[model samples]
Target: MDNLPDEILLTIFDYLPPRILWSIISKVCRRWKNVVSHRVITMWDYNKVLKTHKGVVAIFGIRHQTSRQSPRGLAINFHTLNIRELVLCDNFPLGEMFMKSVHSIKTLRHLDVFTLQNLHTGYLPPPEVNSIVLNNNIQPGYLLNLARRKELKALHMYGRSQYYAVNEMSTMIVIQAKHLTHLTLRCPEISDPRWLVFSQCINLLQLQLYACWSVTANGVAHVLQLPKLQVLHITGSRMVRITALMELIPTLSRSIVELNLSASSFSSQHIALLAATLPDLRKMEVWRCDLTAADVLQLASGLTKLEDLDTDVELNSVDLMYLSEHPALKELRCLYEGEIINDELQAQSHIHVRSALTAPFPLRACGEGPSAGVLLHAHAYKPIDGVTLTI
Candidate 1:
């Protein structure tokens, strides 16, 4: 083992998992320490460790572990890892300092930051994570700085957060992140039209906004102009005006693939217009709406690509029969109380709420968004050759 070339040894170390890298390699002596400490090797997380006696022996070799505190209560467990995607939960002490140091992890491609409380004051932070999750009281300004990292791809910042920014950072940086793909912001402020930050993110694909009370129709209209947005999810408790979106949506035309609305008032007229214009829409979900199954049928006939409808509306046997008239729709999440008019639509669709996975699907309940990986929903759908079939 000692005779092996340094490059070869380093290359081999690259394959080991993050837990193994620190727990296993620390026992290999100072040589492996020097090799492993090289930031490049430790930047991204890895797994699948070697099974050698030497490899097993190396983990216990470290002399001292990292100290527990620094400004921002920063702890660099170099022995720890920077997993590619992150979803932070639970409360952390010294949240400011933690966030500050978290910014320096160049390999952090995805992140979810939350929980902000009063700090000791005057806390300076570092640039680290890429994708972000802002859920706590952390001021918008700190988030702006955190957003500076160029590699960020997805961001979900919730409302009711701390407004700690004395100076507004450039929201423009968000648009500049050339790789950003998905974003969800649920801000409840009734007067902050922050969508002006969307000018540069021309590559954005999926967007979801909830409780954006400050968003005027004009701002949303501009978002429709973003060119690449495929899915839109809007939900809020406040009274938001849709007049601007209504006017702007016609011009901001695209082959939108998906749309999710929770408690939206867009009427039958609105749905009719959307069906006529959005020729590429494959899926649309509504939590509560004024449109009926008959209106849906009319809209579906024109929507050549419409494949799924997730509605809270009930379906009667007659309604189900009417629903069968549209060939474009393959699925419907119908929530009806009357007689069952179940048809082919119910047979082809995979309709399960983010929460319902626990009830009927038999799928494992898990986290949301990026961390929402698949769990066994039904035993019958277990992996066959290599793929799992949906039941």
Candidate 2:
């Protein structure tokens, strides 16, 4: 044992789980302690350790101990971990302890809090976390401290039906996140005025909305007004009126590159409107819409920049024929109910491709753009494997 070199000993110790090494092995000998105190700690969460290990260790009659008392009131090692991502619950004292310990972790990159009540005011942004998710339970005006973290870039939020509270948090998150580029929301019943919150996020490039049923055309129009936004997704939203989108088509023509309107429906005229207005649109998804064969042809011909298209409206032979010859169409997804249509449409064709679009579909449109790794839904029937075909 003592004859082995320090390198060999350290190499052997690396295979053991962190908990076993820290709690069981470290106390065995001074040489083991020296190697572990410096090498074994990098990325770990104390709360997770306590929750998972507290019961399991006791069953095995093993004693697990913490290094120091957390100022957040948890009797765990608060300062030892090199925690880069953190998620806090509704406990205020724990939040306080974290505020104290986070100062030393300069590499913190992601932070999510499920609920926060009466968050302190003396709080200053500790280290910049590029991705952040906040819940609706935050108190009013409590997010001003987040503005101090200049490096914040991506934010995901969940809000409830409360109009005023959601609006306040949305406004604050946008205003504080000056460099924010990507934003995702999961508020089904959020009010209309809250949709206008992104108007302040000038540098924002991508916006994703999930379960956003209450947002009207006015809100989408406001979002379109952003000068730099390139990707827009509105999923699980049925409240946006077709007429409202028709009126605003001219505004989104050039700025948006990717668009998804899953769980929303519109007519063939509206499809023409999108074709004429969205000259630069690269990928478009209109799942569960009332589009006809002519509407599909119009889009394939008019939108010269389209690379991928997904629709719930059934397409026949004429639609497939036009799409096969399209100069730029790279991928086409047809969502249908009863029988498969690929064999009937391409009986004489040489190209045959079979691929999956993911199971259960998306609760909303999948974020940003089409991914090749999703499974096709039960109602989607079977799809041809290839996204594009020649001849």
Task: State which candidate has the highest TM-score.
Answer: 1
Give per-residue CA lDDT, model 2, range 74-169, as digits (tens).
424334545444444333244555566655556555554433343445444465557665544445555655655566677655433122256555
TM-score of each: 0.58, 0.58
Model 1: lowest-lDDT 10 consecutive positions: 382-391
Question: Which one wins on lDDT?
Answer: 2
Per-residue lDDT of model 1, residues 1-391, tens digit only: 7887878877887676333555457457888766655422221111111211122211211111222234232334311344333332233334544555555544554443323453222332233434444444563445554544445666654434323342342353443447667665544453334565654567778776655545666565556666788876654422434564456447653846887654555656676577666878898765545667676666666676778776555555566566565667667666565335344545643332222222233212311111111211111111111111100
lDDT against the true structure, per candidate, is: 0.47, 0.56
RMSD of 2: 12.6
**Candidate 2 Cα misplacement greater than 4 A, ranges:** 1-103, 112-125, 135-151, 158-164, 236-239, 316-322, 336-391
**Error of model 1, residue 32, in angstroms:** 33
